[model samples]
Target: MDHALIEASLGELTAANSRELERKCEQIALSYIAQLVEPQFDVDSADFARDPRLICADRYWNLRFQAAPTLATAVDCAGWMAEHVVAAVQDPIREKWAMGYAFITRNSVESAAEIADATADVVAADDSACNKAYFAALYHAGKLRANFFYDELEIFLAASPLALAAGPHRESVLFTALRAFAAFGSRTTVHQHGCALLDQMWNSAERTFAATDVVLNGLAAGKDFDGRAQLLRDRSAEAVAAYPGRDILHFRLATGRWMCGEYDAAMADIDEALRLLPAIGWRVSHELLQGQYLARRDAIEAARAADRQARIDRDRVQSTEREVDRLAGEVRGTVLRAVELVTVFAAVIAFAVGSLNVSLNGNITLADRIWIVVTQGVGLLLFAFLILGGSWFIADRLARRSERRDRPED
Candidate 1:
């Protein structure tokens, strides 16, 4: 982001003749647009980031508003700060988290302020300050570029207006916090800052707001995919708990749970988001959140249908594999049975040949020899029949047993 255009535009605004200055803020507005369309830098480079939105500084805003709040001076002061104050900038204000944060922050301040008005209702530390001083301070904060988490916020606001009217020699604390939270920073510092920002609901005027994306994105950037998911999920859940029934909060929470890695849980969250979407907030239909959410619903439903089919296919494959294993077992058993039968027959033949040799070697009559041959032949035939009949009987019994199991009994 070559912010030379911002300084140059501010200078141009000062030099414009009365008539031209009164016409429009075309140059200042266009300068911001041009920066937005600038070509992106490499990710590893120090300058590689979407530029933060410009904001008005707190300096001298009190004095200006004290006289009379005019639109012209407000624009002039904003331009002046962009030139002089390093920046009172924040990340762009479009995240669901940021939008939801804005909605909740606005309500939280109002609710807390109301309690502060009533002596008996104040319980929590954040809302316990019932003094007019606290209300006055909060009023000032809301009126002119509220930094809800400024260090020594009370003392700074209590200080004399003239003392607050100094040129900023360094970056505004908000920009510093945003920069640290967004890009790479010390792990411990980023975590501490992110958690602190999460705790405090932010309220800013339309032009002067800090984007919660600075914290949300920074926290996510510090971690890997699953860690990022869990962190966002927990944070969004906390927000939902604090302010229940906000549709945007539910939408953000589901997306955070997140990113479809935990399929079933993520799917459930998406369904809830789709169910809770509101039916309004349209200026141009194209810009409406409802349109965007409808498109998202279509995509999520498609993903869910695909997820269902994938599980069905997986189950079918598992079932087929089990059947294959059973068939393989039967084939293995048959092969083992055949090998055993062959081995037994071979042993019986060897013994019969040995006995015949022994009988022939002994001195004996021709008749004796005939009798021995007949007996031996008969014995061999009987042994063969018995062995084959035993194998057949065993196979028949096994088939019957299997058939019985396969057919359900009446």
Candidate 2:
């Protein structure tokens, strides 16, 4: 409501109570008590003798009447009654929370002290399950409401807090609206747990970044889990193949597959990397890598053979271009490796020349001879790797093949 209208209403409420107004206040209190408790019995009429809620609620209103001296105070008691009754009736998890509310508000002083004690005992002293639940609900209510606030603050920063206060107040009201709710009993606890997990979040980023994903098939928000994982695996494989020397890429790809929960494929990458371990020059491995593939034991081998063909649909799609690129990478890697080997040979030849005293060549010092050798070695080594040395690989392969053919069968 606008400020002026609200101001006028407040002025009317403070007027002295006449006989008519006092009777109205009594009616108002009775009406609220009926609405709160009668609904559960599914009766139009309240049986004061039979219903405990009606007994508690009615007594609560009378207690307010006895305590309140001013007419406005009586009206305020009527309001407080309405709040509790409505709380019980309107709750989604109604009946229970509402009944608790009514029972607690049955006496104001008792409730105030109960709240204070429960707040300290349940929160500080560690109370029973029920009291702790009240505290948990309170904490969740406050935290979730604050989370909601942090979200809206990004956009509607200009709006008053009341704009968003209506919602998220159903279960709680940033703990403020607990007065609107009815809290009944308090509990005393013995001990509390130390190491416990509360929940697992799909997105650690927390603010609408709901999940992790590799880009291609679908976002993490989509229902296509398999599709997202397939894309992630394919991208990882492509990356690994393109840079085979980065053997750690195998471990990384496996990690992504593991996240996808594709156990076999993840282990396949690791197993394959283990077989293709770097040469002695690399010196990386001192132990075994994780093999998730071996997780499928002999028992599963039977199941796999039976279902393997049927599981064709589960295989990740391999694009033609990606495969072709992988092959091209292999070709380039072979050429690179050969060039590296030739460069080593050239360094060895230079070393050998440095060790010799080349007196035959105009009595040149070893230093001058080494420099001459290095200058020629670089150019010839470059040629040996590919320009003139392409034939070397062909000859070597042929010689190996001839030797294999000539050997006796083992």
Candidate 3:
């Protein structure tokens, strides 16, 4: 194996993307596997590990497993790669080999546990580079099955600060740290630790925009429970500026703005993201956010209309009450006037009867006097009935009019 050829091949593999890369990686791994089985090629020699292409091939196979459509297929490929290739890899590269194995074996508790044990051994050896690789592998393995490895993840995070001090591993260490915090950190600690980690990355001149996006995106997904939408918006804005033309970053920024109640700005950002990549998912997201903002605006308007109507109804009810009180007062005055007239009429009738009795007392015979008294009594009774009945009719008419006026509108 020529070293220059291996370097060129690995360089090509790194550059290729999509289906072409997959095909090239597969061909390379199979060719290596064929060589391993050949009788002439010594599998146990240092020459086997000397060619960096073997490690590169291992990485390609890992990529192939990751791209597998189903977990079962991925696991099968991972198992095959571990048995045929990874097990034969020499010591220094074995940590990377183990990390690849752990990544694909995540769905299986048994296989994953084996990888974890291997990772622990690598970590115990205290090789800075190897431990970094091991921790990265551990993080990837636990990422998909966090519930199974929560305790181990916590312990790893506890040692992250010291491990991250070595500049070569800082990026990988930071990535694992973000994932660990997102998965296991408390709501209070998630934002605190996440922001602190992000700040470190941002301040580090060596950090790449791509690396910064990873932490930002991870924090966005995990820290949703914190309700610090404004914080998300601010950080996402920074990310957008740091990584221009990354549509995903713009999308995330839009989401943050939406959460912060800046709908118009959010929509503008969403539109820009869509312009960059007009996928159906982004369109759907755009419509959903638009609908929410419109719904909220409509709800506010409806509430205002309802409140205004309530005020109008209250004023109308007060006016009606005032009118009813005035009608009641008029009724009282009418009743009092009727009472005064009746009293005066009764006094006049009483005085007339007394004078008639006195005039008849000396000049009239007994029969005549009796006739006069009977006739006068009947006349007085009729007069009194007429006066009282007329007063009652007027009062009843006024009371009925007041009731009609006071009746509520339908």
Candidate 4:
């Protein structure tokens, strides 16, 4: 395949409807698999690692797996990465493969455990904090999905100090540790530990409010929301002062005020946020908040309208389902009738064949026998085609009926 064509197809794949995208991806993947299975294709070559087609194929498969996480895709992709990409590559590419493997296997405990076990030697020997932290983050992510792998989480946490000592990965290690603690640590202790880590990270010489925002977001979702609003408010004010004109800080402040039941203040901040960042999503969110505020003010009218709309929507859905079921039943009946006709036709053909054999006997001319066979064969084939065609016609009619029924009234 031409690289430009492949790239264009990939772009189209991204923009295609979900059903069409799945079909396109399957076609692309099969093409890649064909290429991969060719005897001349060098799976171990550096050139293969750098090949654009191979890279695109890898990305396509990864996207498919990410879109729908399944054991089969995970196993296949992991195997391909390990054998065809990782094994053939060096340094940065190899590191990416390791990280990719960890990410792809995060949902499967067995796969993740295998990865940790396989890379233990390298992870132990490597003194780079960034690499260790990267690996630890991967394991920590896996631990989140697989509750039985607390040991993996512990191992990563143990390596945190090494990551902290090395400056490059200090923040990453801390964030990963915070995530682990939030996930598995005792609720009472986890919050305190997270807060301490949050403080340490924020108060460091090179302070990152963005990172602090991440930790605070996690904390906001926790059980202890009593003082979190105040904490968020203080942080939001500080961040705003530090990074003036940042819409996100205003959004953060709005979230804090919303949580604190200060709707007016929250709306005010949301307005500012919207003014700074006039995104459709933000507008939708603002409108939703406004609706909520309105509902709070006029509960009775809002509830009545909501109940009426719910009933209308429910009845519409039920009606559509009934229509679909009716159409499906008709299709099934048509199919059954077609089957019966085919069966009857088969019996008639069998009877005719037997009768012809008896009448013709061994004395029949070779040309006559050939003619009879050909005519009977053609007749049976034509009848089979008619049966199939009739069934499809019924199905098509039913589908058209369904589409007409489903179309919304203007």
lDDT by residue (1-410, candidate 2, tens digit) is 14344234323433433343333334444554545422121211243333334333444344443443222223233234334444433222222222223322223222224334433433332222232333223322222222222222222212322213223432332122221111100012111100000011111223111011111111211223334455446655765665564444565566557556665766666666555543321111213222322332222344445456545643333344445555655675677577667666865675466444353587777788777767666655565556435655664665566456445588
Clashing pairs in 1: none
Per-residue lDDT of candidate 3, residues 205-246 (tens digit)? 655544555555555456455655776788789878877886
Q: For residues 276-388, write the lDDT of model 4, one tens digit per residue.
A: 65233211233544443344334333444666688899899979798777878777877767786876678577758755784577887787777777777677777777777
- In the order shown, the candidates' Cα RMSDs to the true structure are 17.8, 26.0, 15.7, 30.9
Winner of 1 and 4 under TM-score: 1
Q: Residue-wise lDDT of candidate 1 within 277-362, one digit each (tens)?
A: 54322112223445545655565567767878998997787667657655755874685478557756764785578567757766
Model 4 pairs in collision:
none
Model 1 lowest lDDT segment of ten? 41-50
Cα-based TM-score, every candidate: 0.41, 0.17, 0.42, 0.37
Judge candidate 1 against the unseen true structure and give its global Cα lDDT, from 0 to 1.
0.42
- The regions of model 3 sitting more than 4 angstroms off are 1-26, 33-59, 63-116, 120-152, 159-180, 183-190, 223-227, 263-410
Worst 10 residues of 2 by lDDT: 190-199
Clash number for model 2?
3
**lDDT of the candidates, in the order given:** 0.42, 0.37, 0.52, 0.52
Model 4 residue 194 CA deviation (Å) reads 2.5
Q: What's the count of clashing pairs in each model shown?
A: 0, 3, 0, 0
